[model samples]
Target: MRSAADRETAPAQGAAGWYEAADEPELVEHGAVTGLAVTGQGEPGGAAYNESAGALYAVMGALGAPMVPLEGRWWVEDARSPFEVPREEWRWHLFLRLPDGTATIDAARAEVCSGLPAAARVQHVSYTDGRCVQVLHLGPYSDEPASLARMESLMKAEGLVPHGLHHEVYLSDPREEDPAKMRTILRQPVR
Candidate 1:
C-alpha cells in the first residue's frame, strides 16, 4: 500500500489522464499546489469578486512569484444544484499558485501593497487535493452543467462521494472574443 505522503509526492504528470475526460469522468491523483488565496461570495464579476481576484494578482506580483492561471474553488452552505443557485449566492475562493519555494507567505502578506483594498484578503495557502474527478469543458461557462452531470454519473458508478469544494482552473481568459473557444478544467475532489 502506498503511504499518504508517498501518494502526495507523486508527480501528477502521469496523472494527465485525469485531465482528459470525454462523455464521462476519470479519477486522478494530485499533489500539493500552492496558492495566493482570497474568499468572497457573489456574482463572479461583481465588485467584491473582481477586487478579490485583483488583490491576489497584485500581491503575487509584489511578492515576486511567477504569474499562473487563475483557479477557483466554489461551494455553498447547503447542497443544491449549482445551476439552481442565484449568481448572488455563489461563494468562491479565488487563487493563483505560487512558484516553488519562492518565499514565506507571511513575508508576502506583510509586504503586499497593490493599492487595492482587497489586498487585505490575500493569504498564502497550499493544499494537496489528493484524489479528484475532473474533465475539460470546452465552450462557454454557462454550459458546464452538462459536463458536470456526466462527471456525477461516473462518480456514482465508482461509488465515490465528494469531499471537497468544486474546483476550476481557467485555461482560457474569459475576456477572449469567442466564448465558444473558452477552455476550463472542472475538478471535484472525492473519496
Candidate 2:
C-alpha cells in the first residue's frame, strides 16, 4: 500500500495486513519456532492470524524470528502447485529469517520436506521453495473464505494443487486491535 520508506518512516498505522513470512527479509534470530504444519482448506481464509502492525516486531522478538518490511502485490495458490496470476505476482515478501545472513527457508525444508523430529522449545520454522502466491487480504479473517475460494479457482484453472497446506505470514499483531482494517497475507504453498 505504501513505499518501503513509508512502511517504516510512516508511524505504525492503526493496523496492517499479512504478507509472506519471507516478505520481511532480515537476519535470523538466535533460536527456533515451535509450530506445526498449518493447513487451510476451503475458501481463501485464515486462522490464528495476527492483527497489529507495530506489534509485529515485538512478536518476532518473542518468537525469536527475523523479518523485514515490504510492500507489493501477490496471489494465493492451492493445495496443488498452481498460480492465481499469470506471472510471479509483484507482492511483498521477506527473506526467511536466518542466523545473520544464513537462511530462513531451511525450516520449511527440515520441517515440511524432512519433517522435524521434535525436540525442545525453539523457533519453530518452515520453508517453501521459490514461487508462492502472496495474497493480500483486507478485512477480518472470516472474509478469508472468499479469498480461499478465489485461490482454489485459480488452482483448478491452472491445474495446480496446493499440496503444501496453508501458511499465514502475519504482518500485523492482534494485541493492538483494529481488526476491521487489519492486513494479512494467506500464503497457499503450491508444489
Candidate 3:
C-alpha cells in the first residue's frame, strides 16, 4: 500500500482511476471520496465562482497540502433543460480532493479563520457516484456541449438515466493552457 505522503505527491496514483477517461463515453464506478469543497451559484467564470475557488485554494495552502486538480459538480434549479437555464442561474460545488487521512476538518476550519473570509464556507465533504458515463473532452470548454451530447447518447443506448449532477475534473489550467489543448474529464452519474 502507498503511504499518504506518496499519494499526496502523485495525484494520478492517489486518485486511482478517478481522473481518467477516454475520448469516447465509458461506464465507471466511483467510490465515495472526501474533499475540501465550497458551493456557489452563478455563471461558472463569474466573480462568485472565482472567489469560492480562491478560498478553497487558500484553505488547502493553509493546511500545507499538495494541490490537486479542481473538480466541480454542476446543476441548475429550473425545470427547464439545463441548456436552457441561464448561466447565471447555475449552481455548483467546486472542490479539491484530499488524500485519505489528511488533516481533520476542525483543523481546516481553524485555518479558514486566518485566510479568506469565504474560506469559512469550505467544508470537508464526501459522496459516492456508484456508476457513471464519462468522456475525455478536448479543446475549449465552450465546446463541451458536443461532448455532453455524446455522453447522453451513450447513456440512452445503455438504458441508463441520470442519477446525479454533472461532474467535471479539469486537467488543464484554463488561464495558462491553449484552449485548443485543454483537457477535461466529464462525468455524469447514472442508474
Which number leads on TM-score?
3
Span of ten consecutive residues with least summed lDDT in model 3? 4-13
lDDT of each: 0.76, 0.37, 0.83
| Candidates, ranked, TM-score | 3, 1, 2
Q: Write the residue-wise lDDT of candidate 1 on 49-118 in tens digits.
A: 8888888888887787777778889987767776788888999999888766756666666566535667
Per-residue lDDT tens digits for candidate 3, residues 44-77, read 8899999898988888887888888899999998
Residue 25, candidate 3: alpha-carbon lDDT: 83
Model 1, TM vs. native: 0.84
Relative to the unseen true structure, what is the C-alpha lDDT of residue 118 in candidate 2, on a scale of 0 to 100? 22
* Local distance difference test, candidate 1: 0.76
Clashing pairs in 1: none
Off by over 4 Å in 1: 1-24, 106-114
Worst 10 residues of 1 by lDDT: 1-10
Judge candidate 3 at residue 98 and give its lDDT: 86
Candidates' TM-scores?
0.84, 0.42, 0.88
**Residue by residue across 83-129, what tens digits does model 2's lDDT show?**
44423321222222333333433333344222222211123244433
